[model samples]
Target: DPTQRGGVILLSVISPEKYYQTSPLTLEACRACLRGIAQLHAAAWENTDLLQKATQQLSKASFHLTVRNPKELATCVESWKGFLQAFEPHMKQAGLWDKPSIHAMGERIAKLAQYISDQMTPSLVEQNDTTTTPQFSPYATLIHGDFKAMNAFLPKKYESACSSSDDNQH
Candidate 1:
């Protein structure tokens, strides 16, 4: 199961308070999460080597998941369309469909794919045209692409436990 795609290894059990999507979260947890992600981003930000490795792993871990090629742009577009269709009901219920930004985005779903293709495609930029240079954004960081409320987790501060000998002495 560890070798499977989407599998995770949780090593820390000393921290009893684990926050998940359904769990009632404190503002501190959210702040801590932001702080942690900021650290993660700072550590890997604009590191092309690390980014490439992460991207390669992501592509290998999924079915038909090459995202760095301009050819993959169509796939991105179709996937977005599929996602929009699948989530339309929920969006409507949540009043997101009526939002101006969302409505405007509905009109230009292909632009997201175009932006990715232009900014992330490995082979070339400008829709694979040779005249354009790779538009690797300086803003690139270790982003969790699939980060969602369902799988979200927040760490809690834990106090170290005293040993049996120490407890006996106390």
Candidate 2:
């Protein structure tokens, strides 16, 4: 409670084996990961106001971009161009662009640049072509920009089961 201070703390000690272990790269694990991501997305979407407030507070001391207007879209495209140009020399020096796979990816991305810019145009986003197209529009939402498996934890039940199995093996 907010009013309480120095309350008793309960901690569960995990075995070394369990503590060091991570969920295996398996189909079940993949499904669980996707479910967790969907839950996180839903929660963020539901709490958009709170997320926006937090983001605004953080952005005061840093840089933040929101592409809600044509000018912002143009700015984003220009920024991407600048980034690609700045990194191109380093990428080539690293022999990354020499790889067939990387070259193909780069070609695909180049093809999409114009398409992305066209879609981001304010006129396209504001269009109401309901006769031929479905009535759908996209909006920005908060996302976990640094999501990774290393940052996730297994459910408590799985942890306990793993711990029990480890205990039996010992």
Candidate 3:
């Protein structure tokens, strides 16, 4: 029948309009955003079954993913090293490295690289492994990979809806 379709149809919505910030975010606004992010993280982490299912789905999707592993840490270190190697020559050409402050900053970057390398110990990697339920080595949880101020939103209607739902739950 026309009223009872068996197949599902998906609809996509797009808007050409952009939202502009009228003013800089206040301290209270920043705090509120942080609170919202914490809430989101807690909710996702608490759901173990969902976490496992999502992990499985991601694996099946063949996505290269790592959570608090030595390899991931190494990748970060490599990224920093690559950045330094690629930019240091340019900085020197620009006479930036000649400055005492800039030279000190370069030394700091080198120290940071050493620190990152030191953190990749076997004991630490074993401790961070998700298989073991340690007290607090690495509380790996679903994270918003691209969380930023630009992506945050707080519509009154959504807040009211969430509040009402929470009240119902209580």
Top-TM-score candidate index = 1
Better of 1 and 3 by lDDT: 1
Deviation from native of the Cα of residue 85 in model 3, angstroms:
21
Q: What is the TM-score of each candidate against the true structure?
A: 0.42, 0.36, 0.36
Q: How accurate locally is residue 160 in candidate 1, as Cα lDDT from 0 to 100?
A: 20
Q: C-alpha displacement of 64 in model 3, angstroms?
A: 7.5
Q: Could you say which candidate leads in lDDT?
A: 1
**Candidate 2 residue-wise lDDT, 1-170, digit = tens:** 31123122335765655433354333344456678777865654535354454344322211122322345344654555565577677567666656666545545554564465343221212346645532111332344433555545545444554444532220
| Reference-based lDDT, each prediction | 0.48, 0.44, 0.44
Error of 1 at 78 (Å): 10
- Please write out the lDDT profile of model 1 over residues 1-170, one tens digit for every residue: 42245534445544335533422234454455567667866775666677666545543222222433445544655665676687787677667877767655534655654554334432212356646533446655565545443345554341121112232111
In candidate 2, how many Å is residue 137 off?
A: 10
lDDT of 3 at 120: 20
State how far residue 110 of model 1 sits from its true place (Å): 3.0
- Worst 10-residue lDDT window for candidate 1 reads 161-170
